[model samples]
Target chain A: MNRNRSVFLLSALVFGFAFLYVPIISMIVFSFNESKLVTVWGGFSVKWYGELFHNRRMLEAAWLSVRIAAVSATCAVIIGTMAGFALARFGHFRTRTLFSGMVTAPLVMPEVITGLSLLLLFVALAPLPFIPDTRGFSTITIAHITLTMSYVAVIVQSRLSSMDDSLEEAALDLGARPWKVFMVITLPIIAPAMISGWLLAFTLSLDDLVIASFTAGPSTNTLPMMIFSTVRRGITPEINALATIMVGIVTIFVITAGVLMARQERRRQLETRGAGR
Target chain B: MANPSYVTLGQRILAGLDKALTTVMASPPYRWSQGILRRAGVTGRTLVIAVPWVWLLIFFLIPFIIVFKISFAETRWLGSPPYAPIWEWVEGHALHVKITFANYLFLLSDSLYVQAFLSSLKVASVSTILCLLLGYPMAYGIARADPSWRNTLLLLVILPFWTSFLLRVYAWMGLLNNHGVINQFLMWTGIIDEPIVMLQTDFAMYIGIVYSYLPFMILPLYSNLEKHDPTLLEAAVDLGCRPFRAFLSITLPLSKPGIIAGSMLVFIPAVGEFVIPRLLGGTDSLMIGRVLWDEYFLNRNWPVASAVAIALLLLLVIPIVIFQRYQLQEASGEQQR
Candidate 1:
C-alpha cells in the first residue's frame, strides 16, 4: 500500500512537471532550427537570431517595452507599498473598505472589461483642460501601472503581515517617530518583498498584451503587440528565437532569487540553533 | 529658560524641528528642512493613502461607469467621440437626454451574443474543473515532498508565469499545429497514418488555458495542504481508520476553501480569456471576450462592445465578491493562528 501511494505521488509529479515544461523546452530547442518549418528537426543554427536583430520593428518594440516596464514597476512599487501599509496598519480607517476593494478587484477582473473601461476613461478625459490628448506612451504607462500595482500591493501586504510588528513598536518605544521608525526599521525588513514585488510588476507589464493593445496609440506598439501581429500571420523561426531570449532572462532572475532566499534561510537557521544552545 | 510659560507656537515648532534635525543631521538653522518636514507632518499618511485611492477611483472604478454609460449611447461615425452623447443642451434653454436600450436589447435578442455568453460560461467552468483535477494531485505531491525539495518544486511551478503570456500561447501554437511536433511524433510512431487535427480545435483551447492557468490552481492548493497537521492523520490511522477514509473525512473537507479559492482564481479570468481563444480556438469560437474584441475592432460597434463588457462584469460580480470574502477569511484565519 505504501509503495502504491508513493508511486502515485511520483507519477503525478512527473506528469505535472513534464506537462509544464515540455512545450517550453521544445520551443527552446527549435529556436536554433535552420529551416523555416518549426516542427521539423533541422540542422542547428543561430541564423534566426541574426535575423531577429535586423528586424527593426521587433527591436524598437522590445526597447519600448523594457523602458515602460522599468518606469511602471518603480512607480508601482512605491504606490503599492503605501497601499499595502495602509491595508495592513489602518484596517478600520474611513475608506478602508473601498480602498482595499479597489486594490484587490483588479486581480481577477477580466482583462477585456478593464481595458475597455480604461480606454473610455482616457477618451472622456481627453477633451478636458491640461490632459494629454494622445494615447501612446503616457496613456499606456498609466494603464500598465494601474493593472500591475495591485499585484505589488498584494505581495507587499502579505510580507508586511508576516513580519514581526515588535521591531517597529520597539523603535517607537525608544522615542522614534512613526514615520522615522517605518523608514529606519520596517523598510529594511520588507526590502526583499519590495524587490520581488518590483520584479513581478516588471514582468507582468512586459507580458501584458490586451490592456496595452487597448490603450496604445496607432503608431506605438509594445513587443507583445508586435508579436501578436506577426504571429497571427503564421509561426516562424524568428518568434522561437525571441521566445528563447525572453525565457532565458526570466530563468536567470528566478534562479538568482532562489539562491539568495536559500542562503538567507540557512543563515537564519544557524542563528536560531546558536541561540538555543 | 526664556520665560518658560511664554513660548509661542511658532517658536515651539522651531525648537522641535531644531532638535529633530540636530539628531538626524548636523545642520545649520533648522529653517531649511522645516518646509519639507512640516508638510510631511501635516499630511504624509493622508497623502500616501489618498494617492492610490484617487488613482484607483479615476483610472479603475470610473472607467466602469463610463463603460456602463456608453453602453446606452449610440455609435456615431461623424462625431468626435465615436459614441453619441447621452445628454446634450438643446436650443433656447431646453435640456435634451437621449438614452437607448437598443444595445442591451440587441445583445439579449441576438442568438450570437446570447450563445457567446453561454459558451464562455461553459468553457470557463469546464476549464476550472479540469485545472482543479490536474492541479490538486500536483499540489498534494509537492506538499508531501521532502522539505528541501519543496521550495524548488514550487519555484519551478511559478517560473513559467514570470515569462511572457503571449509567448506561452505561442508555444502551444508550435505544438498543436498540423505539422507540429506532437502530430509529427504520433505519425512517426504509427499512432495515426495522417497528422490528426489538433490546432484550432476545442481540445487545443482547453489545453492552452489549462496549461497556462494550472499554476494558479496548484499554488493555492499547495499553500492549503502544506499547513495540514500530520498528527490528525496519524491519530486516525492509529485508531484503525483507513487512510483513504481519513482523507475523505478530514483532508477533503478541510481543503474546501482552498478548492473554492483556486477555482475562482481560474474561473474568473478564464471566462474572458482573449488570447487563448483567439490564438488557439477555431474561427467559430464564441467567447464573449473575443466577441467584444471583434465588435470593437472589426465591426467598430463601440456601443455593443460596451454592452458586452457590462454584461460580462455583471456575470463576474458574484464570484468577485466571493473571492474577496474568501481572501478576508484567509487573512483573518492566518492572523488568529
Candidate 2:
C-alpha cells in the first residue's frame, strides 16, 4: 500500500509540474529560434532579443505599465491597509457587512463587468469638474486600484485577525497614544503582510489586460495591451522574446522572496529555541 | 539668563508662539475639542474606516449604480455620450423621465444572448470541474510532501501566475495551432498521418482555462489539506477502513470548505472570461463577456451593453451572496475555534 501511494504521488508531481511548465519552457526555447516560423527550430540566435529592444512602441508601453503599476500599488496599499485595519479591529460596526462585501466583491468579480462599469463611470463623470474627460493613465490607475485593493485588504485583514491583540493593548497600557501604539507595535508586526500585499497589487496591475484595455485611451496602451494586439495579428518571435524575459524576471523575484522567507523562518525558529533555553 | 541676551529674533518669536499654543491647549474650550476628537475615534479607527469607505462608495458602488441606470436608457448614434439621458428637464418646471425596458426585452427575446449566457455557464462549469480533478492530486501531493520541499513546490505553482497572463495564453497558441508544436510533435512520432486542428476550438478553450486557473484551485486545497490532522486518517485506518475509504470518509468531508471556495474562485471569473474565449475558442464560442465587449466596442451600443452587464450581475448575485456568507461563517468559526 505504501509503495503504491508513493508511486501515485511521484507520478502526480511529475505530470503536474510538466503540465504547468512544458508550454512555458517551449515558449522560452522558441524565443531563441532563428527561423521566422516559431514552430520550426533553426539554429539558436539572439536576434529576437535585439529586435525587442529596438521596438520603441513595446518599450514605451512597458515603461508606462511599470509606472502605472507602481503608483497604483502604493495607493492600493494605503487604502487597503486602512480598510483591513477597520475590518480587523473595529468589530461589528453599523456597516460591517456592507464594508466587507464591497471590499471582497472584486476578488471574484469578472474583469469584463468591472471594465465596462468603470468605463461607464468615467464617461459619466467627465462632465463634472475635477474629473478627467479622457480615459488615459489616471483612469487606468484608478481602475487598477479598485481591482487590486480588494486583494490587499484581504491579505492584511487575514494577517491582522490572526495576530494577538495583547501586544497592542500592552503598548496602550504603557501610556502610548493610539497612533503611536499602532505605528510602534502593530505596524512592525504586520509589515511583512503589507509588503506582500503591495507586491501582489503591483503584479496584478501589471498583468491586467481586459480592464486596462477599457480604461486606457488610444495613446495610453499598456504592455499587455500591446502584446494582445500583436498576438492577435499573428504569432511573432518578438513576443516570445518578451515572454521569456518576463518569465526570467518573475522567476528571479519569486525565488528571492521564497529564499528570504525561508531564511527568516529559520532565524525565528532559532531565536525561539534560544529564548526557551 | 545669559542665553536670553543671545537669543535671535526668530528664536524669541518661536518661543512666544510655543507658549501661546500651550496656553490655548490648556484652555477649557481646546480641551473640550480634544475630548470630542478622542470620543469620535478620529485618530485611527474612524479615519481608517472612512477613507476606504468613501473611496469604495465613490469608485466601486456608484459605478454599479451608474451601470444599472444606464441599462434603462436608450442607445443613440448622434450624441456625445452615445446614450439618451434617462431624465431630462422639460419646458417650465416640468420634469420628463424616459426609461425603457427594450434592452432587457431584447436580451430575453434574442436567441444569441440566451445562447451566449448558457454557453458561458457551461464552459465555466466544465473548466472548474477539470481544474478540481487535476488540482486535487497535486495539492494532496504537496501537502503530504516533506516540509523542507513543500514551500519550494508551492512557489513553483505560483511562479507561473506571476508571469504575464497574456503571454501565457499566447504561448498556448503557439503550441495548439494547426502548424504548432503539438501537431508537429505528433506528426514526427507517427501517431497520426496529418496534423489535427486544435486551436480555435472548445477543446483549446478548456485547456486554456484549466491551465490558467489550476493554481487557484490548488492553493486553497493545499492550505486546507496541510492543516488536516493525520491522526484522524490513522484512526480511520485502524478502524478497519481501507486507505481510499479513510480518505473518502475523513479527508474529503473535512476539506469541504476548501472545495467550495476553490470552485467558486475558479467558476466565477471563468464565466465572464473574455480573453480566453476570444483568443482560443472558435467563432461560434460566443461567451457573454465577448458579447458584451462586441456590443460596446464593435456595435457602439452602450445601453444594450450596460443591460447585458446588469443581467450578468443579477445572475451572479446569488453566488456572490452565498460566497460572502460562507466567508463570514468560516471567519466566525475560526474565531470560535
Candidate 3:
C-alpha cells in the first residue's frame, strides 16, 4: 500500500508539472513551425521569426511600450522610494496607518475601477491648461505610475525598515546634511530594492492591458492591446511568434537573476567563514 | 537631485507657505506622534507622503465619487452624466434631481444579473476549493522536504508568474482547444475516440481560474505548513489518533488563516474578473464582470455601467471590511507576542 501510494504521488507530481509546462513548450515549438497552423507541427524553421521582424505594427507597439515602461518605471521608482522611506523611517505619525492603507488600496482594487476612475479624473481635469487631456502617452504613463508606485513604495519601505536606523544617525553625527547623508548612505543601501521595484514597474507597464486600453488615446495603442485586438481578429503565426519571444526573454532574464542571487549568497558565506578563520 | 522644473505653480504655492503653519494649521493638523518624521529627512518624508496622497485623492478617490454621483443622477438621452446636480429654485425649492431606484431596480428585477452574480460566486468558490485541494498537498510536500530544497520548490512555483500572464492564458488557449495536445493525446491513447469540445465552456473557465490562482494558494499554504510543528502530528499519532483524523484536527485548524487568505485572494479577484470569462468561457456563462464590460463598451450604457460597478463595490466592501478586521486582530496579536 505504501509503495503504491508513493508511485501514485510521483505520477501526480509528473502530471502536474507536465500540465504546467506543456503549453509553454508547445508555444516555443510552434514558433519554429514553417506552416501557419499553430497545432500541426511542421519541420523546424526560423521563417516565422523573420516574419516577426518585418511586422511593422508589432515592432512599433513594442517600441512604444518600451518607452512608456521605461519612463513610468523611472518616475515610479523615485516617488515610490521617497514614499517608502517616509513611511518606514518616519514612525508614530497619527495618519501613518491611513497613509499606508491608501497607498495599498490600488494594489487590491479591481483594474476596471482603477481604469474607469482615472479616466473620469482625467476628463474632469482636462480643461486645465497644463494638464493637456490625460489620454495619450502621458496619461498612460501617469496611470502606470499611479499603480506601480504603490508596489515600489512597499518594497523600498520594507528594505528601509529592515536596515539599522543607526546608519543614518552615524552619518548625521559626522556633520552630513540630511539630503547628503541620504544620497551617500541610505540610497546606496536600498539601491537594489529600488532597481527591483523599477523592474517590477517596467514589467507591469508593459503587461498592462486593461488600464492602458481605457486610458490609451487613438494614437497610443500598447503591445498587449495590439495583441489582444489581433487575437480577436484571428489567431495567427505572428501571435505565436510574439508569445514565444516574450516567454523566452522573461525566462532568460529571471533565470539569470536567480543564478546571480545564488552566487552572491555563496560568496557571502565564503567571506563570513574567511573572516571567522 | 532637485529638478529645475520643480517650481510648478502648485509647488511654488506649497513651498511659499510657512512649514510650521502648514503642519499645525491644516484642516486635520499633521499629528507628529508617528516617530518616522523626526527620524527620516523631513523634506523627503513630506514630499513622499503629501504628493502620493494628493495624487490618490485626485485620480483614485475623485473618479469613484464621480461614478457614484452619475449612478444617482438621471442620465441625458445619450446616457451620460447629467448637466446639473442637485438644485433648488424660487418655485417652491424646485429640485432638478429626480432620484429614482430605477437602475438598482432594473438590476434586481433581471434574473440575469442575479444569476450572473451567483454564477460568479459559484465559480470563484469552486476555483478556490480546487486550488486548496491541489495546492495544500503540494505545499505540504515541499515544506516537509529537506530544508535545502524548499527555496528551489518555491522559486519554481513563482517562476511561471513572472512571464506575461496573458501569454500563459494564450498558452492555455492552445492547450485546451479541440485539436489541442491533451485531447489529442487522450484520443490517440484510446481514452476517448472522439475529440472533446473544451474551449468556450465552463470547464475551460474553471481550468483558467485554477491555473491563474494556483500560486496564491501554494504560497500561503507553504508558509503556514512550514510553521506548523511536525511534533504535533507525531503527538497525535502517539495519542492513538489516525493519520487522517490527526490531519483534520491539527493540520487543518492550524492552516485556517492561510486558507482564508488564499480563498479571499482568489475569490475577490475572480468575482470582478472580466478577462477569463470572456476569453475562456462561453457567451452563456453569465458572470457579472462580462456583463459590466458589455454594458460599458458594447451597450454604451455608462449610467447602467456605473450602477453595476457601484453594486459590485457594495458587494465587495463587506468582505474587505471583514478582511481588514481580521488583519488588525492578527497584527495586535503579533504585537502582544
Q: Please name the candidate that would achieve the greatest DockQ relative to the true structure.
A: 1
Per-residue lDDT tens digits of candidate 2, residues A1-277?
Answer: 7577777987888898898898899999999999999899999999999999999999999999999999999999999998988888787998989999999999999999999999989998899999878788999999999999998888888888877688898988889877667655677667678888998999999989999988887678999999989999879999999999999998888888788767766766776676678
TM-score for all models, in order of appearance: 0.93, 0.93, 0.84
- Candidate 2 chain B lDDT trough over 10 residues, lowest sum: B1-10
Enumerate the chain B TM-scores of all models: 0.88, 0.88, 0.79
DockQ, cand. 1: 0.53
Residue range B1-337, candidate 2, lDDT tens digits: 1234444443465456656766886899988987998887665467779899998998899999999999999988888789999999988967889999999999999999999999999999999999998898899999999997998899999999888888899999999988899999899999988889999999999999999999999988998899999999888778888888888888899998888888888998998999999899998898999999899889989999999999999888887887777677766665554
| CAPRI category for model 2 | acceptable
- lDDT per residue (tens digit) for residues B298-318 in model 3: 876666667888888887787
Candidate 1's C-alpha runs over 4 A off are A272-277, B1-42
Candidate lDDT values, in order: 0.88, 0.89, 0.75
Compared with the true structure, what per-residue lDDT tens digits does model 1 show for residues B1-337? 2235544453465467656855765454445575576767745677779889988999998999999999999889767678899999988967788999999999999999999999999999999999998999899899999998999999999999999889989999999999999988998999999988888889999999999999999998999999999899889988999887888899889888899999999999999999999999998989999999999878878889999999999999999999988887876576455
The DockQ scores of all candidates, in the order shown, are 0.53, 0.49, 0.30
